[model samples]
Target: MATQQSTGSTLTRAWANTALPTLGAILAVALWWLVTVALHIDPFFVPSPADVLDAFMRDPGFMMNETWVTFSRVLIGFGIAVAGGLLIAVLLAASWTVERMTMPLLAAINAVPKVALAPLLLVWMGFGNSPKIVMVVLVSFFPVIVSTMAGLTSTPADLRELGRSLSASWWQTFVKVRLPWALPQIFVGIKVATPLAIIGAVIGEVVSPDHGLGSVIVGSGSSADTPLAFAALVLLAITGVVLFYLIVAIERLLVPWAAAIAS
Candidate 1:
């Protein structure tokens, strides 16, 4: 009976935790609906939840297709950014000379506004997925590189010494000790980058006006379909939230120790 009670309590706590966010979301929507209806605000300026839902329901097919396109770009770009950032970080961490030589250049590049570069990317890469993918990589890679390098370099000196004493090879030390230690920080960078990836993809699509949620938003705006545009924005928000939580879920699964430490 005690064990069963404990399990029930645990389940209740988890449910409560999950319900809190849903409650907040419901309250926000309620407030928005109330304010919009009470003030009789024009839907063109700020669409009501019903207006946005109506727009979505009007043509769910097109919305889903565009959403899928944008999502694919985000996924591809984010994956590349993570892989490339990790490789670059490892290289930089391994060599003081490389870190010193390349760090300044990278910092300078990252300092420039990614939006300012979008037009140039469209000009160079033309109207296709290339510019969008490149934009996503550019925006997402910086945080990953920085966080991963920090994690790699911050491994305890004693751990290095212990590995050396054990006659462990560099690869072995990195794989068995340094990498695991760095996982948490690396995940931090990845989580930070995910939202940026979405923004980058959208920025690219907005500049180029190709097929994606961004393009849908742009077309809707030009056509004065504010509700449709708002619907697209809502989809983008949902995408970001879903991707962020997906990353968190992956972190919990792959690096449960890090999740436990964080908790």
Candidate 2:
């Protein structure tokens, strides 16, 4: 009976988790359709769902291709940011002098508007993928660094003492204890950065307008094809959502304790 009750509870929680969001999305779409109909909005300005669907269906292959382009850029940039950020965070945590010397400079650089830098990036990188990838790294880097430093520096005093008691070397202690503790917080930063990486890719694409969903949106806007623009936007939204959830799924698999705590 206890086992059955436990299984039933787990199923109930899973249903609630999945069903509520799906229901919410349905209601939001219904509301959007109603608003378009009631307001008698111009399809050229703000398209109805059916109009957007038609636009998507008109050039499904092109839309998918652009999406893939944008996603690939995001993946590359995000990967670099994660690797670089974690390395920097480790160095900063290991040395107070390094953290003090570099933190302010990093903050200043991060303060510069990414959009403003896009044009300069084009000049320097010459309309290549480099600028887009760099933009993604810039946008996504800080969160990871901050979260990782927080995690590493905030390792419990008891844990540190325990490591010392075990006569562990600094490297051994960090690898065996500190890094594991930091994993959850590192995942937190990754989840936060994932969407920003996509935004950075889109911004780069918008500036260049060479290819990607951002370029598609730019082209649609130029032609005043609101439905097509909306379709591109829908694709971008789906991509961001899927990527974010993919990261979350990874976090759950790799850091199950964090997921349990969060739940």
Runs of candidate 1 with Cα error greater than 4 angstroms are: 1-8
**Model 2: per-residue lDDT, tens digit, 143-214?**
999999999987889999999999999999999999999999998899899989999999999999899999
lDDT of each: 0.94, 0.92
Using all chains and alpha carbons, the TM-scores for the candidates as numbered come to 0.95, 0.95
Candidate number of the best lDDT: 1
The digit string of per-residue lDDT tens for model 1 on 66-151 reads 99999999999999999999999999999999999999999999999999999999789899999999999999999999999999
Q: Per-residue lDDT for 182 in model 1?
A: 95
Over the full model, what C-alpha lDDT does candidate 1 score relative to the true structure?
A: 0.94
Candidate 2 Cα misplacement greater than 4 A, ranges: 1-7, 261-263
